[model samples]
Target chain A: MSEAALLHNSLMLGAILFAVGMVGMVVRRNMIVMFLCAEMMLQGVSVSLVAWGRFHNDFGGQMLVIFILTVAACEAGLGLALFVVLFHRSGNLDITYWQELREENQAAFMDREVPEEDREKTIWPQLTPSGVEPAANPEEELHRSRV
Target chain B: MLTANEHLIGSAVVAALGLWLMLPPSGERLRALGLVVAASGLGWLMSRMPGLGTWAADAAFWSLAAATSAAAVATVVSRNPVYSALWFALSLLGTAGVFALQGAQFLAVATIVVYAGAIVVTFLFVLMLAQPDGTAYYDRVGWGRVTSLLACACPAVIVGVLAMMLSSSLAGFEAGTATVAELAANVRHEEHVARLGGTLFTDHLVAVELAGTLLLVALVGAVAITAQDRQKTDARKTHGGGASR
Candidate 1:
């Protein structure tokens, strides 16, 4: 049980944690899961930071962790804000729904009945390239096409 | 070679056991067992060293920090945002321990208050508000992750190289030195608040004030961006409703 042994343990733990996070990030399909993976990665770095700080008897690493926490707070705030916006604009939280929101992209076969309320909030009408008159009830036109 | 720090050996063993219980129970159990055994051995060795109580304490702090960080990673990668946020808070607490070991008691407490208490609470708040759907999220963005990883690789390599060089240099200087102990003792004897205040005022005065101002501005911006006009939106969902609208 020497200093080297302690360090080796720290390194091993850090590596395993990092690998788990990476695998989760890669394999997970949910946005929330992806966020979790990113958090795991952040945790890995924090562990390394504390280990390095102790190994060298420096406070700089501690200070850096503080900064990282602040950045994480800000990131979570903005990310959730964006997620809310995406969810509201689209009926579903699925990423596939997001492609319709992407600028300059036309959905190949998304013709579906849109409720009047949904039509007001929808962005697809504005993106349509054809000169055809705007449907009196675009929701109905969308609904009819989908059927 | 028994030392004053021998008392810490017990706590170290307990901590190692806690870690073992925290890990996965499958193939990873062997690795966790190995870590616990190694930690126990390391604690025993530390007890045999003379005048190494502070070093032992510091090592313990680092071990806790690393464990917390690893836990955070596991949480994040679990595809459960709530779990990730939980690990993130644990990591913050571990950082507080590291700060305490570095003899910055105020900073340590502050780190916990700001990160574990405030920031993590906010993270949970956001998670609940966002209600991020997980099942179909990957179908959309999975292809782009590899590109992002490649983009991050160069910086990671550079950071890795820099850290190795720094660690080697510091190890060389600290190998057989008594100077650090004297310095640590002197700093402790002088009230930390006074020294830190004097240094901050005399040398880093502008930076300190700027940081304060920046924090204030950020606080205001967050409130403004998240705030909703009562006339425009329902009270129950003020923060997230605007984006959806």
Candidate 2:
């Protein structure tokens, strides 16, 4: 393809990716989802840089993208580790669990009303009770559920 | 001609409406409608890209770009975190294809390896530990009302403004053709990854070293942050017989 055509395509794709990521970052409540959105934004920028570099007829864009990959790897490692710690504290990945960390004067966010779900009985995979079904002790059953 | 201002504006509007509807806490009916609208909007935008260069490359670009954008939307909107992670991987692969099309062979492979191999696994491991039996409650819900209104509009604005900027940016520039020696003086004449690496080592070696150091620091930081009093778990292990605790 001609450089002009490629530039147009790459820039447009990058824009869409960045925009979608911004929306996801703002609206999604799960911390992992939020992190994924951030990475998506990075991908958008990388696409644009590559397009410019290609248009200019050099590998400069690729070089920058390599660095982006490095930083992203670091971000992934530390971010996921922190996520584990946060999950231990909140018992779930919901960002709302950390609302208390918001600026002291800011009012707590009122959650939007979710339309009621049908609450269908989801069929979860269960092992055939192989040993002392539910393990005699109720507390043991609780521990088993954690896995 | 395909990506004229009016066409871009129309696409941005349609996509914005779709995204607004898709954000959670809305009824499932609206989310379905949103999916159709958003897909069409993105499809129209992709069609606007002029693909006259060659048949085969155009075909690949069209298919890869479409898959990448669709997967991107799915990654954001899927209520199940596991499904989201899967969708994100598909998107990553599609992006890698785009990179390859643009002639960044090394970056493409690096993207697939570092992202599909590492980041997604970490996300899944975290999700496996944190998820309940089904979709979590928060995954089914979006942000509050005021936040939603503002957030949902951001993509449309960005797409529209970016479209205008791209058109303008193309006006004053021409593609440069660099000879091998021009790009990498020290390396032997070759194409693809060889040239990429030659440029890296000759010109940007310092940045590469710094990146390595950053990776090391981040590794140590992750380990330190996740470290805990091992004796606590050890003590529990002894008391509980350690079989399945």
Candidate 3:
């Protein structure tokens, strides 16, 4: 393919990838999924950078992508650490647990409108037991609820 | 040309709609319908692409893009965080394939090693800690009805505007951009890494050093942050919170 056509095609594909990531970031409540979306966005940017480098026949774009990869590694280390701490504090990984960090003017996200799924309690799967059930410990129940 | 542009724009919107439907809290039947909708939308978009001037290469490119995009979509919609991480890994591999096909051998391998090897593994570790069983109530119900609609709208509009702007700028793209003519020497496939390394050390040596330092700092920071909380959790556990599932 011609250099220009290759550049255009690569860039268009990158843009599409970036848009998918943006939608994921906006819609997903899971902290891990949100982080994955951020990485996806970075992936999109990497694709564009490589394409640009190839088009110019220069190493600058690829070099920058290398740096981005490094930064992403650092980000993953720190972000996962943060998630672990936060999960420990709240016993859940819901982003709403930290909604206090939202902008001052923004209305709160929690207790907004309960979705159909959220309204109904989670139904844990059960199987028939051949033996008598052990009495549930309060401490174990607390841990189970947290899980 | 006008009709082509409309198809391009319309396809994007359709795909976004299908993706929104696939988000958490949807029924299995709805998800199936969304799969069809999303597939058709992507098909329309691919039909408009200026293929790589050959059928074989075009097929390869589209296949990679499709795999990558489909995985990304699944990652976004999956309620199970473990599944999301897995799907993201698949997407990363697909992207690496794209990079390899585009003559970026080193970068493709680097992406696979760094992201799939390290990053996804780290995510899975943390995910297992917080959610051993894949599904959680919060994961099941993503957002309230009104907010979900707005969430979908915001990204759709952003993507729509971006597409329109990019398309509009196509005519002026080549003229508006400047190339570094001095660094235009062609490198062979075998020497691609050699040349890339030379350029990195010569032109961007300081940046390389800075990146190393930044990584070290992040390492220290993550360790310290997690360690500080460990003592507190341990103390709490000792106080009759010794519950293990």
Candidate 4:
């Protein structure tokens, strides 16, 4: 195959892999699965980058793939740590279990009952409107108070 | 348009349908059928594409692509997290193969070592620690298969169309007329790793430094988060007064 054809084929494969990752991210509820899918997407992008570099006769794309590898490693580490912590708090890795972080007015999607022990671990702070309203006229309020 | 372009569109549609079938929440019987269908569809699509220069190279590319996509599908559809991780390793390996085929031997090796070796090990460790049992509730159900399929299809179609368009437009360019063997020879003749090193140290030094710093920060953050979680658990143990569970 010609270089352009190779590049085109690789690009198409990368795009397809990326789409698969997107679908996986959307469908899977497991945090680990979601993280893996994201990595897959990165892999797809990396493929295209290398292909482009080869096509253009430049090493830039290869260098960028290296950086992508570094970032992916870091992301995986942090993501796994977060998953561990979330699992500890909730006793499960179901992403839906952490819906308390969603906007206040939105109805909660987490229908599963949390164990009493786990519930104590998850201390979701109540959002309350609390600060005192500023006076319409601070000087007038001060004078009126003095009077 | 050209016959090749028409085939590409047809292949994309078939592959999309295959993917739609392979997503989870299906019955065991249907899932098996979906796997076969998806695999065949992808394989057929790949075979239909214009061959790379040498028959051997083309075969290698097709096999690697098939393996990568198949393993990826398995990774998402597997009910067991361990199996998913293993499948992900296979997928990563296939991706590395694709990388090597693209003249990125260094990146391919790095991907194998970093992802398959380190990252996958870490994930497996977490999986074992978090869920000692076989399966979890979230693994089996709760996936909005149809909705996710629809969402994924939109981007797939758009990307396919765009790639086709770009390739078609660039068809007249003579810059990429080199055959696969010549391309391979060019890549082989160059000291890619040394050149990459030079590029890193000269052109992308700051970015390299930033990436290093980012890795350091991420490591520290991960350690801190895990440590804090441990402390919290210890505190709860003390507060609860003798294993409340």
- Which candidate achieves the best TM-score against the true structure? 3
Q: Give the TM-score of candidate 1.
A: 0.52
Query: Candidate 2, clashing residue pairs?
Result: none
Q: Name the docking class for model 2.
A: acceptable
For the second chain, the TM-scores of the candidates in order are: 0.58, 0.83, 0.87, 0.85
DockQ of 3: 0.40
Local accuracy of candidate 4 as per-residue lDDT tens digits, A52-144: 888866778888899999999999999999998998778888787776777869876664543122345337789898999776987787769
Candidates sorted by DockQ, best first: 3, 2, 4, 1
- Candidate RMSDs in Å, in order, are 14.6, 7.3, 6.6, 16.8
DockQ-derived CAPRI band for the predicted complex in model 4:
acceptable
Question: What is candidate 4's local distance difference test score?
Answer: 0.78
Q: In candidate 1, which residue ranges exceed 4 Å CA deviation?
A: A1-76, A91-147, B1-59, B62-66, B132-171, B175-178, B185-190, B223-245
Tell me the interface RMSD of model 1, in angstroms.
8.0
True contacts kept of 4: 0.58
Rank the models by TM-score, top first: 3, 4, 2, 1
The residue-level lDDT of candidate 3 at B68 comes to: 92
- Candidate 2: deviation at residue B219, Å? 0.7
Model 2 DockQ, alpha carbons vs. true complex:
0.39
Which regions in candidate 4 have their CA more than 4 angstroms from the true location?
A103-147, B1-6, B173-188, B241-245
- For residues B1-245, what per-residue lDDT tens digits would candidate 2 score against the true structure? 55487787788878877877777766789989999898888877676666738888888888888898889888888888888888999999999999988777788899999999889988888888888565886777666555666886777878987777676766453345344354343212246777788789989999999999999999999988778624445666779856432
- Whose DockQ is higher: candidate 3's or candidate 4's? 3
Each prediction's TM-score versus the true structure: 0.52, 0.81, 0.85, 0.83
